[model samples]
Target chain A: MPDERSADEHLLAERLIQALNLEHLAVGELSPTAALFGHESGGLGLDSIDALEIALMVQKHYGVTLRSEDPDTIAALTSLRSLSAYVLAQRKQ
Target chain B: MPDRAHVINLCAGRLAFMLGFVAAGLRGQTTLLPHSLAARQLEAIRAAYPDCHVLDDSCKSDLQWQDSPRNASLDVDEQATAAILFTSGSTGVPQPHPCTWGSLAALGRLDAQRLTGSRQMNLVVTVPSQHMYGLQTSVLLQLFGDCSVHDGKPFFPADVAAALRAVPAPRALITTPHHLRSCLDAGVALPPLDMVLSATAPLAAELAEKAELLWQTTLLEIYGSTEAGTIGTRRTTSGEPWQLLPGARLDCTADGAVYHASHLPAPLALTDVLDPVSSGSFRLVGRAADQVKIAGKRASLAELNRLLLQVPGVIDGVVFVPENGSRTAALVVAPHLAAAQIVGELAQSMDPAFLPRPVVLLERLPRNELGKLTHTALQEAIR
Candidate 1:
């Protein structure tokens, strides 16, 4: 069978790119360990609204429930790798 | 007892005036306005209703203005009518829209069901308290939604983060597109947001998505005018026809123009150009009155000028028509930017007739506290 979790992560990455109109941003530019939000130079600046929008989209499409009260939501969305890893974990759950 | 039916509306009055309205048999319904009216405006209204008590927003200074939390004692009919506030006129005047407690209350019911699913809401309003959007979403809806209203205005994103951090959980944000955009620019960590509601100026879809992703909340945009109260709301990216509130209508005439009606007082004829999707919904295309007649060519000066403002390095800009029938002149406010260079860039977006020739440069345009511009004020800058 296909690597379902990896496929889901790619699908989500595509959705985020489309949502943000980041067509100029290539898939390779988005590494597993690339920063999603941080003070680092060249980091993709995802503001709070973008964070919320991504969380909502994840919930709406993948059946992942992101509670405002979640302990890991802020941490899980910190980087491309973390988010993909979190989504994979969520799929298992 | 003057039947209470003849009185059109009642709003947030001082504790004393609140008593007078009840004592005189007026239904004391609260509409969302700033905590009070300025002393002069209140005095004029007092003259109009000598028997009715007048609540004045008479603070000694800005320091006092920031400290007051207006509470009222009147137990008027919760369903009584209230005043309508219009967008402040571009002519340096303000417009008032009339609404009723019954109509606003109905909206609260719809919002509460959609938002809270029957639980009470705790609201943290980020917009100024006076405007129609604030009144409907922050104040009146607070009462009808069974929400506890906070007494503060959070401007900077840091301030907003701090307030949300301190407030009780399950807090919702009531704010404007301007304020919301500023927050996103600041890169602050937001406290939990159950629901985020924004109105006043239009909120772009990208920004709305950003907001939802950051807070893990649904960001809903409200569509209505000061005249229409709140007709309907829609999701930012849904692109669906607006679902009208329980009782609302958009009447179209032969000329393809739209008029508005609701459980509101007297029919409101709008200056907008809209394509009605159904009896209840329409897609608004620029306002008809916003069209400028330049040498017999009809053009949207607002959009044209807005494009000028977006030019790289341009901070704030506006093009006001010369009331004396001269061509439209542009006035710009920027930091050490050249007026001549901006005109060169604006040439790409505007026709020669619509182009602002001999652009007037100022460090800042003279706008009122609300950031609204006027033709007269722009003219004064050029002169």
Candidate 2:
């Protein structure tokens, strides 16, 4: 199968796995398009605590701050692909 | 709305929750507040209270407001049940404790005396109104005490900051240790606040000191539970013992400690171990056996182990909190199922916060000739 994840998505996935201490999961197993929050989303099933950790990780790595009140931030957090795009877009500015 | 004995309040907005609660009270209907809004948990609650109405944000559209006479005196029955809050008991079933209107009013008054002290403060609360802590600080305080609440439950650090900024001066932040830690770690610039209140989990002195220094506000940690509302308060940075609220007393017994208050209908036995420092002050030692708190939510280790063993192809398993560890760890002897697979199945019934991390799979659990799993043996297996 072709590698569907972009380079930035792969790097973000690595950081997420490490930051969340998800030793059970590997970088390649994380789907770039999968939902990252809800339990029924058939994704990593991360919760609010995991979201905070991701925000901290993003701030440290890309200098992008994810605010909870922002509608764009909420939309970006829906999936790994969206989060990667949001981070790249923020860094460009 | 059809006549019902109770209303299951699942409203996400604070205003909706308060309105539904007061409307139910006016109709002599009790409001049920479940610990979580998870589908399975709500289903269990609905099964128990089959006749209760489920009130949610969608019901807001159905609300028709009518202006009442100005300064009309609203009479409330003191003995009527106001709300029933659920706590996840050790048996894996949620136990409900009913709070009367009188008791809730007393608790709100006491909380105000200790927390706000006659100040008409605006609160930005991060916890849900369904929980006891949230209900006391956000809803009851606003209704009975001198305070108003922001309508939203802000989750993220930046969101909390924004909410606080939106509120007027003399603002307070009502949150848990988990959210407080996240807010501090995110390093979001927060507006100046009069006070910050924390509960649900024990706040570390260091964290409290840091919060006080950064926010330049007094940080108070409340000690209470679902059964007893706002039993005591402590300035976390002072490292002092908890001062019991007026008219509240703690008595140590052979079985366990029991809390007593004039407002409570009966003396309630406490699940937490307390160290009595004085007649009016005590220090919390820890929770009783089988109860573990993870990220401000309580679950039973025994219940977790039962769920783990109930998984298909699971032979034997034990869920335990490792010494000095906050999260639960599990050792399972299931050859057919992988660790992640077991966790995935467990997640169906358990909250994600209570899910065991680092589930270790072993061929067999170390047991003695007496068929007992000792601490030393379990530690060796995990190691």
Candidate 3:
């Protein structure tokens, strides 16, 4: 199930990068667990500003709203896998 | 509270930030404004001020407020240390710049008169409160002037619009050139606004004009630095030169220029060399240190950056001179345009010798809270 979730997140992240017009990065370059935000950029090299657009894209595609002030936002937006799991759980609710 | 608190951490929402700012002053604590609330950054501030308390949303709840104005009068000493702001270090290390309550107040008075005008506005700030521009324009303006502020540091165009809608008219939007560009790209419907204020970096006049047309409001760009604070402003649509703020004067020296303002206790020398257009107006020549003698043709990294951003398909970009070599290189965020395409277009307008070699196409620049790229970040990116 975890492996399946990982694959799902990887695909979602790839879709996200593409949707955001992040042409500098490719799907293959980033790992499923790569850090999406912060100074220690795992691979994709995103930031606080990038988070806003990504959140909007997430909502548009997945019908999930990610708020910055939410305590779970940091954990959820940590990586593609985390984001995917968070979105999956959020949508179910 | 002791006789004075050397350092006080300020991390909270907009209203808390405002309340904490006033509370700290009353308590004689110099608010330590960190550029970001990152662990390492906060650790550094904590290391500097060991007694620092984390004043986040959780702690803000502990603070008590009165519904009615207090009968007891609290005297505010104008000369007291208000905050010690750290620069984004585009030039070098994030150096501390201490500002007095008087200094901020003086700038606020001018901002209220010039930027806000006669209208009583409700400011919807897109920039973070920790940022100097955000601290002064969005938060301090509301405090000093007859205006109110919305608490959220709204991002995305929709959030920005919603934030604007939350506030009553005549409303003002305080943001950066980068944020404004993003808003324009989103093309989200914004509520009617009285004015728009921009700072942090040089705003292209074309974008400024487009913003005015889209929002149907005046767009004003503020020109200042961490060292000098807000010193000049201009209406970008008219393509007018930046006029010095009231009680501000620039005296050009052989090196750069000396910055003198009534708010500042003493005259401070600025790193940027200015070309005085008139008595109180000047054009930015470039930073004295940003000049590079490439191929015996002098050019400014700032000007090259301006040209890089102007390129079609280029979303965001920066041109920086490598410390190891005389040649220049650019790390551009233009995913649509290839490195060769950017170079080819740049060659048409700029000298061939000054064109960035091996222009690095980046997903995004490592801009700080103020939307500025530090020299260290640029070096790391190139590496």
Candidate 4:
């Protein structure tokens, strides 16, 4: 399969794997559009603790804070593609 | 419909769970609270109780509702088994402990008197209702203590803050140390709360002090287990011993302690090592060997290691919580399988929170000649 992730998404994916300590998952193996949370979905199967780690990493790396109460923030965290776009957009601001 | 002896209540929402509880109670059936909703655990529960019915949020009843008199009285059998709460035992299997209606009601009333002085309070709980702590504070308290609980189980710091804001005054946040730390780290704005209840694991004095200072509220930590309901409470920041609830007493044994409560059907021998300071208060020393608590969930490290070794292509492995670490870590000597593959296999039987983070693959563990791993050797290997 062709790699669908953009340059920004690829960078964010590497950071996520390192920050979350996902040693088993390679950046190339990660599907950018797949679900980021939930066990049933064919995704990373991360939990709330990982979510906190991701939030803290995003804040430190891109100066972007993801609030759970914000629907936009939750939506942005749905997948790597969306999270990359959200972080890049926030960084540009 | 054929009658069943028990009903597995898997409702995620508080209201739906309460409704399921009441329906099962009215039918004279015991509610089975599984330790987790994981497929493997649920399968074990089903295998044990072949005649039990499973109920969840997606379950719909075809029966039409019939209006009853407003003042109709409901009779309850206090001696009947109300719920069988499953806790992860040291042996790795989920052990079921039955709670009678009388005991559950008594627990609720005792907790209410001790925590809220029987006052009407709104509760915003972050823990799931399946857990004993969540069931006692959120469901039982509401049923017998005249309190109300928010239906949604709000997770995340911002969501928890929003939930607290949505509720009125005299609100209590029933959560764990992990969740409390997240909320504090996020530094989200929260409304004034009457009290904050922490349980499932020990709360640090510094974190409790920070919460008390920031929220200007009393931060009370509960000491109890699934076997014994709410046993004691203490103001975490005060560095004080836990004050046992009324009608609860501890009898120290050679190994550990035995907990007796008015709500319990029988005395339960506790796995926690305790030091008695007074007649009604005790200081927690530590837990017995093999038990590890992470993110409010308790599991046996020995059992986890056994499960790790049981994974396919896993020749040898050991799971341990690194010194001063929050999550468990593992060192495996599986040359054929990757770290993620081993974790994925273990995830089938274990809770997600207990899964080892940063699983390190090595050629072999630093085991001694007797094939026994020491703490120092394991720590050195992980490092």
On TM-score, the leading prediction is 2
TM-scores for every predicted model: 0.51, 0.90, 0.73, 0.86
All models, RMSD in angstroms: 16.6, 3.1, 10.3, 3.7
Sorting all predicted structures by TM-score, with the top scorer first, yields: 2, 4, 3, 1
Model 3 residue pairs with clashes = none
Scoring only the A-chain of each prediction against the true A-chain gives TM-scores of 0.78, 0.91, 0.78, 0.90
Ranking of models by DockQ:
2, 4, 3, 1
Q: List the lowest-lDDT window of 10 residues for candidate 2 chain B.
A: B65-74
Interface quality of candidate 4 as DockQ: 0.46
Compute the lDDT of residue B75 as modeled in candidate 4. 48
Clash count, one per candidate: 18, 0, 0, 0
lDDT of each: 0.58, 0.83, 0.72, 0.83
In order, the candidates keep a fraction of the true contacts of 0.00, 0.45, 0.05, 0.40
Question: Which of candidates 2 and 3 is the stronger one according to lDDT?
Answer: 2
Error of 4 at A65 (Å): 5.7
After TM-score superposition, the amount by which residue B191's alpha carbon in candidate 2 deviates from its true location, in angstroms, is: 1.4
